[model samples]
Target chain A: MHISLKPELLFNLGSFPVTNSILTSWIGTLLLIVIAIVVGGNFKRIPAGIQHVFEMVYEMFEGMATEVMGAAGKKFVPLLATLFLFIITSNWLGVLPGVGSLGIYETHAAAPAKDTHAAPAKDAQAKPAAKDAHAAPAAKDAHAAPAKDSHAKDDHGPVFVPLFRGANADLNTTFALAIIVMVIIHVMGIKSAGLSHHLAHFKNPLEIVSEFSKILSFGFRLFGNVFAGEVLLTAMASIFVIITGNNLLAYGALGGFIVFPFLMLEFFVGFIQAFVFAMLTLSFLSLFYKTENSEPHH
Target chain B: MLESLGINPVLMLAQAISFGLLYYVLNRFLFSQIRGALEERSAAVSKTLADKTEIEHRLQAFEQEQKAAQKKVAEEVQKMMLDAKDAAASTKAELVAKAKDAADAEFATAQKRIEQEKVAAEAEVSKHAKTLAQSIVQQLLSEKASDPQWQQEQIKASLESLKQSKS
Candidate 1:
């Protein structure tokens, strides 16, 4: 399987390449902007209708941030608020059944985040049941072009097929996020503490081995959660397809409705991840500086 | 990975960048403006309340002044009434004094007339008494002188005449 980083336009370099995912993202972004403008523009001393709704939302977010973070938390309100809105929006964008259904030059694609089989997975632990049900497809469609090599194998000339997908679906995206967050934590720690002092955390001869192990544990724990979540989603989607027939009449509609709640859950997960990443950085920085609330030696 | 996912990576990054930029711009222009306007409106309302309080204070002071002026006018009216009463009392007293003096003068004149009448009556009574005494004395003297000489002759004649007359 191969993943292409480069994408091509429909005709010329300046022309737009019509893909359903691209179209959906653009539509979502455009809608968000338009709503923001209509709500925010022509403001009155007394708020009414849409403006009032936005005000309430802002106040809610502001209150939550202050409650969780305290005085210091107020400074991070804007960042947290923006992150919350964007992540929820992106997660919900995929829930629409026809999000990437039609009006594209490319071959049939459904969700922008959908994987190889145009099917999503759910719960990796349920893979056994899902595999048994979906194994028939792989066996039957042996002649079908593999997703990774589809573009290359297409004999109808050299078609510059696009391969970039939603950043959240890929492990590279999650891993990169984890590493970036860790690096930011380290840099902040070092800045707060002298390099010598920061290094002293792991430099103690008595627990040097343990410190190295702890670092490994941290990385693995993060990777495990994110990877598992992606795989589980894939498997679940497959099982869903199998339970329903080739027609997939009932399950298809149910899946569309089911995605709404799952999207909400994913939105929550995204928020938790962002918060964990940020808080971890803050705590690490505090630790390096010996300013954090350390436990009593006794 | 694209084969396995049936999707692209470059498109994803592009999407992320687009979204991030859009958010940044909207936050800067729209949201912040609304927030600022709300703050300004709150401040203005508070300021207006303060101004209204000041005006009410001034009005209260004005009412107090008016009450004081009204009280002063009432006092002035009372003083005028007292003064008028005093003048009327003095004028009435003067009129009574004048009337008493005129009456005393009339009484004195009446007393003087009574004394004059008493003196005149006394003089007239004494004169009448003197005249009556003189008449009685003359009659008695005439009777005594005639009777002694001619007493015997005449007495006899007259006695005869007197007896005749008496009979």
Candidate 2:
């Protein structure tokens, strides 16, 4: 069976259907709550070992959120901090061998993102003519079998399972995140500018179409960035398989070791994406809704 | 494609709304407590530092006053000692003057007594000498009574003649 960034594994209960992306999101959510609970459980005047570390992290997140989101973000610190912690945790969690490499019901699947087949065959050029004759029939048979068994019930087809997976790798997840952020932006705008003024941004008689173009661009920018990152990471790991003749997990591991620098990039990208999402929403809201007495630049 | 796994937009929105609500509620309770505790702890520490500084300042002032008091006490003791010395000298001078006056009066009285004794003894001695001279003169008058008057007159005349001659 072909491997892919399968978000479906999380949504199923036995034969019942459930969304993997949602499942992963829920796991991320629970993980955040657990961390918050653990960190915040013991309250004392003098912070001790683990609490000290957690407090520093909390303070750092608070500072970043306030810096990016501004004074208005003071109230939203917990929410933004929670989101940042959860998303990063889920993404990093996908690097674990059991979570990223282990396939549900025992198969080599795209652990974090669905694997892609995009490597140019290096040896194909060595004996192309002779290899083509032998490979053509196999390819034809492969195409014909899917058509023959389209309605046949297969127990081992693409299905959902409950496990850890990359939350941003799934389009539904990123799309949902984007939409939520946008909605929050609108809500914030409305809260700041009031209904009429906030809506005025979209209701320009001369530039109504341009307003829509701007909105589309804003959403698409976030969508494209996260989507492309997931796709690229998937592609890089898949290439390791073609060159090294290993399973997706082995390739993923090898790719991780070789392309570790890229993973670091991914880490930073993930943080920026999260910050951008929150900041854009905040800015959009402030621009539309902020009172005249508020910061003039906003 | 993900619809097979129930990746519905409706469900996504529903999940987001529910989580957001949950987060908001939890934040109101949990986050508020944590944030409040941290703020309170910091405030307490600041208050403690302020209190410590205040006490220290008061203590410093008290110490300064104590040092001044000690200095004043030493000065007072020195003044008292000087006064005592002055009193002792004055008393000694008065005693010495009284003793010298008494000695001078005793010496004067003794000298006056001695002079009076000498005068009295001289008077007695003169009287005795006069009596002896009278006895001696009576004896001599017995022997030469006529000659005494005559000699006295003659001597007076002769002394007058001699005085006229000499004059």
Candidate 3:
């Protein structure tokens, strides 16, 4: 099994390397947008169906935000709610059946050489041996020659690059979210307590460190949780495959017995991580606003 | 290190833009609309409740007024009945007195008519007696010229009796 910390590069969009995680982020964004339009397009005082579900989710986040930040938090409900929804959607989408498993084979030469870690390269080279052993009897002869030829050419073989990755699994997406939220928080802080008062908090060295650390904490907390979950599932799946010896029936049964529980665990983790991210942002906002309110005005 | 972790500036910016777009869409469609609906529904409910309370109070007052008016009307009817009864009693008494007076006046007129009739009858009777005695005296004088003094005495006696009865 090939596992990497980085999301696989899907393609280049006019010099921009479109990673799988960003693509998944876009999908999550599009899904949210569609739901927003659908629910927001024809609003009723009495909600039903998908509208009801949407309202329920919205109210849940809204309630949490309001509870955390008081009435001032009412205005930030959209941001908090979007973050929760997008993160959860992307996380859950990552755990889907074909998300990490389904992808095109990219030869090591054709693949981007930027993020070639030794461990993943070794894993990629080892994957073909495992694949040959698991190949069907009818197709083994047909695939063996190519597999041998590819192995003969280079020490490294083709790497399996997934077309989709969990958006939070990528540090870029999580860091982006963290940066945006922190920026907004600071902007709000400045707006509530004049620029000088807001900036004055940075006078203390620890305060500055804490401010920067918050971004790292926010970004890595999500990225680590999601990335770890992906790694755990991959490890568990590889174990199941090894135990079943590539037998389809035994693999299916072992996967159901072993991987299913972990999948459930991942699902729970996904939601918890999303909740943590949102609640943390809300709490931080509350803290900023609370300090702003408590401080004497000039 | 960031590149190894697959953190790209362009992708982060893109994700941020996507999130910003999502936020704008959600704010426009979901949060604002739901908040407005909730506020509107709350206001409508309170207004309706207020209107209901006002109507209930008015209804209660109206019922009380209706009850009071009913009581007043009943009292007025009772008073009118009493007055009518008293007026009827007085009118009956007055009519009885007037009827008694009229009966007394009619009895007096009948009694006076009776007295006048009695006097006229007696006078007619006396006149008839006088005429009969005169005829008897003339017949007797023709039969016996010697008995004139006795016939005159008889006529004088009859005239004395008639005068006593008239008096």
Could you estimate the TM-score for every candidate?
0.44, 0.57, 0.66
Per-residue lDDT for A1-298 in model 1, tens only? 1222222222222433344335444565676677777766686678888778656655555565444444343434444444444434434543322221211123323323223333334212222233222222432232244433323344432222322223333333333334444554467557656698778766667566654444444434433443344334333444456454352434434544544455456556655654454444334433443323342111
Ranking by DockQ: 3, 1, 2
Q: How big a share of the true inter-chain contacts is recovered in candidate 2? A: 0.11
Q: Rank the candidate models, highest TM-score first.
A: 3, 2, 1
Cα deviation of A241, candidate 1, in Å:
4.0
For each candidate in the order shown, give its overall lDDT on alpha carbons: 0.48, 0.55, 0.74
iRMS per model, in Å, is 5.3, 3.9, 1.0
**Pairwise TM-score winner, candidates 1 and 3:** 3
Binned by DockQ into CAPRI classes (incorrect, acceptable, medium, high), candidate 3 is: medium
Q: Which DockQ value does candidate 3 get?
A: 0.54
* DockQ of candidate model 1: 0.10
lDDT tens digits, residue span A1-298, model 2: 1223335443335544345445666676676666556656665657777556545645665675456556565665666555555556556544322332232322224432333331124212322122122122222333344522212244344322224445655555555555665666668767877798777776657566654554555545544565465445444544545454444444444554554555566667767766665555555545554644555145
Check candidate 3 and list the clashing pairs: none
Docking class of 2: incorrect
The C-alpha stretches of model 3 lying farther than 4 A from their native spots are A111-155, A243-249, A290-298, B55-167
Most lDDT-accurate candidate: 3
Candidate DockQ values, in order, are: 0.10, 0.10, 0.54
**How far out, in Å, is residue B86 in model 3?**
15
